[model samples]
Target: MPMKVRGAPQAVVAILAFAGIVVALMQTMMIPLIPQLPRLLHATPSDATWAITATLLTGAVATPVVGRLGDMYGKRRMLLIGLALLVLGSFIGALSGTLAPMVVGRSLQGLAMGVIPLGISVMRDVLPADRLGSATALMSASLGVGGALGLPAAALVAERADWHLLFWTAAGFGVLAMALVLAVVPESQVRGGGRFDVVGAAGLSAGLSCLLLAVSKGVDWGGQVTAGLLGTSAILLGLWGWWELRTGEPLVDLRTSARRQVLLTNLASAVFGFGMFAMTMVLPQLLQLPRSTGYGLGTTMLGVGLTLAPSGLVMMAMSPVSARISRARGPKVTLMAGALVVAAGYGLGVLMMSALWQLVFVSSVIGAGIGLAYGAMPALIMSAVPIGETAAANSLNTLMRAIGTSISSAVAGVILANLTNAAGLPTLDGFRLVMAIGGGASLVAIAIAAFLPAHRVPAGTLPGREPSARRAVRISARPRPAERAGLPGEDE
Candidate 1:
């Protein structure tokens, strides 16, 4: 029999949300070390960048694979394994003085990126019906919070202490998160029991590695190398799609993904992801550029991070608001509202970059949009897919967003590199151009969101919600007065 573990719903939600934030925090924790990596590790500037590139590549490959494993084996088991990897990676990083070990450690850290999606999936299986929406909203927005908060925290650590302390602190946090999961979060009884698709897994990994590596390194690698990698990626991905369709149990269910609601949401996610990265990439550089540049703010790294930190808080604060909107108007409308706001934020950013306060205001507006949009995506996806497929579906959606960010990074890099001033710094015009493109990307997402179903059962109501609640009623042999009055039933 599947083990059905139970616990206090609120504690479970908090533990999972904390785990999600910790995992997301790993993504940007190393940014402050990038310039110093060459001198510290005795490597060329290009080679030192692998420390960041390794994480991005590994994260792209691991997210979907781990999600499938969680669905087949157990989500809590997979989540624990991810946290264990995070701890091990941090320990390795803490000891590393060379680029090689640092890259290896960062790769392992990336593998744990699956934890956020798995945490959201667990909420669906465990939380009470009414608690599920807000819980998942908070979980989804945790990524933005971790990333925004990590910048200042990491900058402070890099400035004051031995850089290795960053890894040690990360290790300590991972250990704490793991212990909380073991103590509080329950193993989900739901499972998509099937033979592991080894061939599908390998095909997808190889394809994504080639695709993402090409996109990420294209600006640095020049045209022929980028073209060759793109060709290889396209061929491998095409074959993988063919293989998945023929397999008994595929790694990703392409047919389910092709559904109008799911298809549009994923499409919007990619564009929204593209829109999201523009601010993260643009704001810090603009804030830290030399004061000699006509528009540069000349702030220190710590100041840049602090200035942007409120955006993360704004995201967190918007989570419940997103849930409430999803509950009232449907996730489709919530998503549209979010994309529209993000577009407006970028439009404002283009006109407001002369002052730090303007940048903060723009970042916070963009953050709120991202929070609403991110909170709505899982709801749209879960509502359209089978209950057992939750983790895998959410993971794929996460992967799509990662792909969008990778593309955004490449596009922004090319623009900045080519649009430099006499001092070799990015010109104000280049920053404005990137902001315009970001707004355009959000506009595209809004257009896609418009095509989604006008109303699917209210967002965040899982496919299994009513059935599971009814089962709870039967097992308890006493329905709550709210259940007896059919409030949960009204969601359907």
Candidate 2:
């Protein structure tokens, strides 16, 4: 008789899903407060934007480090640590009355961004093989859902209650998530076998911080500072790459990252991230403008939020469809479809800005595109790299997306600044220009996807069905041992 098998705990999955939601919620919970920050904190627009910048910078630095630690120590423990940091940060922000302390708290809370990937790693340990793919897709979608759900909720709280209450609620959620994780999640045996490269981590942190700081601050700081920061960042990044190449156990395997599948997927992820944010940043402003402004639709905050909310719903609904499409046509094809859909959505936005429902339709279409793209990326990266490097590689891809968002923010600011109307309000013309640029960028991503090699296994095959074929592909597609030996073990 065949042996009976034990299934993963449903409670554990629930806790992990909740954890993903809370982490994602924190990412965009403050977005509604963006315009209000100047008045509430008595700061300039550029200074207030630091709240966003601080979180992005800290999250970017922490992601790869946390991923490496998850490999070396344990994902469950790392997840708990990240959640704890989030709770503490939220509490600190709630108590703060000034911008500086608030910025500090926001930066600390950014550590939580690493929790979802860590939780996904744990899910691999607990979830049955048959259910892993769907579970992974759901967890990935949770990130977008949490962000979308948090916005209106946060806006309502900020409007009716105190702004500080938002952070308090976040703190409460963090505590509950941590407790549930502790009670339900089991530890895994996936452990790293080498020393962690502190130097590489430091280099990466410095380089990314410098790069993001420049990008985030460039709108106010002008061309000289932006050029200088960008130049310094380039040099630091080059050095960081060399340091990783020579390190005993670097945080990221540069060689694996250099592989065609891994490299192109991450690059495409950056553009995907950029495209996603472009619509998000511009659309709300377009909807909330005064009707007299000629280009404004005069929608209320609540109305605007509701309209945008459906886009998120569309994204959630499309996750399964994206996975199915990926299975049938390969992830590369799904990715191209996603990029093209987003580009089409942007084109639609340019043509239909006057009508509120038209905006809603375009948003939903774009959200569906992002959902399809986001769901396929992790699977592609995981398939290409070794199991041990899974968290780090995935984290690096996530960081690329973050980098792309940061750059998009800068680019959008520049475009808006250059194209304001006579009343000092940003016009529909600027918004259209931004959307068109985003669409063009998505086209670039489609081209990249089109050129990607077709080496993926047919969907739904048994894992061990073609080891030799996988190895042969890996040999040709992966980097040489001489190139990767200093970084970490080759991807499985």
Candidate 3:
């Protein structure tokens, strides 16, 4: 009789994808709690806002460092460490009744964001070449999936249960993800054996912290403080670049990253991130805006969640389709196509701002485009970089996306803040302006993607299908660098 069970590759991919979704859920779960934070923590609004800032700051710092560590030691090992941080942070967030502990807890949660890239790297090392495209795409889409689905659900829980329950819930899921990783996910033996680059890591962290703090918090801190932070970031980043070029065991391989494909992909990733977030920030406000405003839909948070939830599903659903496009056309083409779709979606959003259905249409269309772009990104990065540096490259890409989102928040917030109506509320014109910007950003990303080199399918192979021969070369049903290739194990 034929075997009754799923393939080992299938199990590993499923478990890791679930882990990605859970970790992503941690990010959006806190959104509904933001408004109530000042009252809940008995602090000023500015102090309470630190909960969000702390996570953003820590995430930007941790993504690259953790990626390098994952490459040097073990991808699976670093992923576990990331999950542990999530569990610990979730519990801390649950127990905290004040701003300080809350900030600390949230920072740890930010640190856990590294797991997404690590998970993607592990997919490359462990999965058969054929499974690589689709699995990584799904894992990447989980970031959006978790965020979209998390909002309304998180809002409901915060509205009814004690808000602490949200963190408790996240902690529970983190524990489940940990257990799944131990049981199903194999440790990759593909270690980039080298000493950790302390100087590069510190320089990058300081530079990112300075820049993101200035971008994210500039509105509150005023122009001079923002200028000072920006100046400091510039100096630190320049020094960091010099040190990286000199370091024997650099934390990030600037030379490899400078290659045309990797460089352009990262640039486009940032723009795409900015475009995605512009929709995320504006749509909710449009939904919640008071009915007295001529354009407001006047919906509840739950309505917002329901409207956005379908986009997450659409993103998940589009993964295989995106993969097919990448296989048939090159991922560069896939990326450009995705960016164009996003541009089209946002352009439609600018005109169709009237009803719930129109917003749903807009979100779903944008989500589909984002899924395509994100799914193609790993393919572009992994194809360009060596097997050993997969984690680092992917992590760096993720960092770019995060930076893009931060910038989007700053820029979008500025637009909405300044373009207010007579009553001082953001007018329909303000949102349409944001939507126009989002479309323009997506179009810009498409232009960037146009610069990417074309991909040619080797002769005698079918388009849109992973080579069947490659699919058959299974690697010992374990997640290690191939013994056939004389690769060293993680313990080495």
Candidate 4:
């Protein structure tokens, strides 16, 4: 019989789940503050966007590195480091009364975004096999739940008290998360006996930063700067790819990543990320526009946050349902279904933009789709790779999603800029166009997922096998000729 571990598993789950929630909360706590930027910092709308963009850009660059490092060193160690960064960043932001300092703080907070994947990895390490499915689902839902819950609360705090208090609160949460991780999380046994790829890291970071900067600022920066930055990014990224292929120990294993299933899944993930963020980027603007525009809902920040907040609840409710569907049918099927749901939701938005409840309904539908899709992605990647490659592959998947969101933001901004209605005001038409484009991208993701092969392994297979004399005998006595030739009843 297997040796039973001590400690209440439920308590372990709660600690990790809360830690994941705190990490995700850091991502969207600034949403409510967008409107107050002009008054608080005396800055332009474009300048204020930097506060959000800075976090995104920094997170995009740091996620893959942190993920790889977590696998190499230890997930628990990295989780603690990430939480420390979150607390430090919040403290910095709390001390700030200016735009530049706040932006710096947001960048530091981005470092903590790595905690989500690290937390997920910890679940794989600690949870019993039967319990892992539900635990993983809840942990994934924490990303959406934290964002949704954080928004309304952050808005309430910002509205009633000082905006700086929001960061202070986040700092307190970060400290709590650190303590929980130290207390409950186990150290990883996995170790990478290779040097860190410094060259690849630097090259990839520079390339991605340039690409994201061009995308985020293209609306204001005009053609020349955009073209220059994009060109430089392309060249640097190409060089990085080549270097990764040649290096024995790469930051990301380009060859392994280039596998059909891995590549397509990641490509689909990018599109999914793009589509999901489009709703987030556009909804607040639509809600807050002046009533005179005839299309605006003219809602307050708190009201808008509440209205959109139910979508997170929807995601939380769907998490276990998605996991079950993936287990029963397969992850690719679940992913395709999610893409279709998202596309359908976007289609609904295009038809019913005038009604407030319609927007709420559509947002919830999209949130459900996202929850389903997000839960399936890591499972799909983990299924396809060796145990040693888990973190690197998952990190690449996360990075691809970030890249997609950056591109989507740029495209949506351009659409809104060009398609405004009369009276020099942005119209619902621009928003419609953006959603339509996002819907089309979801279709592409569905098609990609359709072609993904299904390979289901029985329990107690390769990674789960115990190191015992019976296991060795069982392995040695396996039918060799049939297995080698890929005949019927062969070992997959």
Residues 1-492, model 3: lDDT tens digits = 111223398888888888888888876887777778899999999888899999899989999999999988888899999999999999999999999999989999999999999999888766766667888889888888888988889989988899999999999999999998998787777777778999999999999999999998899999999999999999999999999988777888887777777899999999989988988889999998988888999998888889899999999998888788887877888888888888999999999989999999999999999899989988788766656777999999999999998999999999999989888878888898888898899999999988877774333222222344222122222222222132211111
lDDT, candidate 2, equals 0.77
Against the reference, the lDDT scores of all candidates come to 0.86, 0.77, 0.84, 0.76
Number of the top-ranking candidate, with lDDT as the measure: 1
Residue 107 shift from truth in candidate 2, angstroms: 0.7
lDDT of 4 by residue, 271-380 (tens): 88888877876777788888889888888788778878888888877877767876677667778988899999999988877768988998899888887887777767
Report residue 259 deviation for candidate 4 (angstroms): 1.6
**Model 3, CA-based lDDT:** 0.84
lDDT of model 2, residue 377: 76
Worst 10 residues of 1 by lDDT: 470-479
TM-score of each model, in listed order: 0.94, 0.91, 0.92, 0.90
Q: Which scores higher on TM-score, 2 or 4?
A: 2
179-275: candidate 1 lDDT, tens digit per residue: 9999988888777777778999999999999999899888778899999999999999999999988887889988777777778899999999998
* Residue clash pairs of candidate 1: none
The TM-score ranking, best first, is 1, 3, 2, 4
Task: Give the poorly placed runs of model 3, Cα more than 4 Å off.
Answer: 1-7, 457-492
In model 1, the runs with Cα more than 4 Å from the true position are: 1-6, 456-492
